[model samples]
Target: MGNAEIIAGIKIPDSQMAKAVTELVRDTETDLLYNHSRRVFLFGAITGERKRLKYDPELLYVGTMFHDMGLFDSYASETERFEVDGANTARNFLKSYDIPERDVDDVWDSIALHTTPGIPQHKRPTVALVTAGVEMDVLGIAYHDFSDKEREEVCACHPRGLRFKHAILSAFCYGTIRKPGSTFGNVKADVLERMDPTYKRENFTEIIMGSAWDS
Candidate 1:
């Protein structure tokens, strides 16, 4: 049987999967991975909000977090094809949520295609929204500074700062890509206007990236 089939056979309810996700996120000690997921959520949510995409913020948030849940799956360690395993695991877990077919597909596709570069570019607004979210997620993984254990420990206690860091990190990571027809051009502007209401984009980028630990 496929991993997805096995996961589907598990009796965990949607509510319980949600609880499991929440607890996993809460206890995750890997700051880098946690922050990367947070940025993907913020980026996806903001893009969806600005474009009026039909995706529910709560759904996007959960999917992004659990999109990578399979990394911890036994499959990731056993098989070389972790992305496929991750996608299957996500689809199975989401099915427990009774999530719509379309949204489930979206989340699955995002997880599946995130690491593979050079796929044919998509042009749909919703596709673009997800693509940008996933791209920013990769950028965060490739570039973010997660070395300041003290800051991460401190920010963990300050949920507000953590939230701000999440948003800012998303902006810093994916804010520069002007993908064809991308709405990100205005995204940074919106976040800055909404988050700071005063600073220019250059200042925002400089300040946030400067303060983030690079090593």
Candidate 2:
């Protein structure tokens, strides 16, 4: 019901759904995650603009906001990948609002595959941009691509805080430590290895050799 605020030349979606999502995330997630999510949306929108890709702003906003929800205690699922838990949470929330199946699927894919590197880049605009935003923010994958002004503005609105790298790593560790097996075959394995000395990674070759097939 209010004017949409523009960050880095991208308008934050001000729809009812957007407001509801913002409120829910702000209440449920830590300040770190809530701010990170907002930055992700802003960065992703900036990337989409640079790439000249057509995407739904509202869907992208939802995907970015919910992408890390799985890392929270309330949404974390036992035995499921954090990414999948987040995706499922977003999917359910969207369905409750009667979002179209295709749009919901895009948002779900965006969240589920945000942690996976190679594929999301080839998907639809929203899915691809979600990963783009995350990589830019966390991994610094395209850090220089965004100008100093752009980065400063986005971070000014949602400051990464004094120890974002350490804080985010700790967040990842805390979120997945309870379900260590869920970190296999993904980047979170590195997180666990770095944070938990007792954690051992699952080797793909060993798994293959240990399979039931006798050939």
Best model number under TM-score: 2
Lowest lDDT block of 10, candidate 1: 3-12
Per-residue lDDT of 1-215 in model 1, one digit per residue for the tens?
23221111121123455567656664642455555565555555555554566655455556566554544434343433344455676677677676778877776676656545455136333334445555654544322323344224323432334355565444433322222122123333444445443444445466667885984
Candidate topping lDDT = 2
lDDT of each: 0.49, 0.95
Tens digits of lDDT, candidate 2, 10-94: 9999888999999999999999999999999999999999999999999999999999999988998889999999999999888
Model 1 lDDT at residue 112: 59
TM-score result, candidate 1:
0.48
TM-score of each: 0.48, 0.97
Error in Å for residue 190 of model 2: 0.4
lDDT of 1 at 175: 29
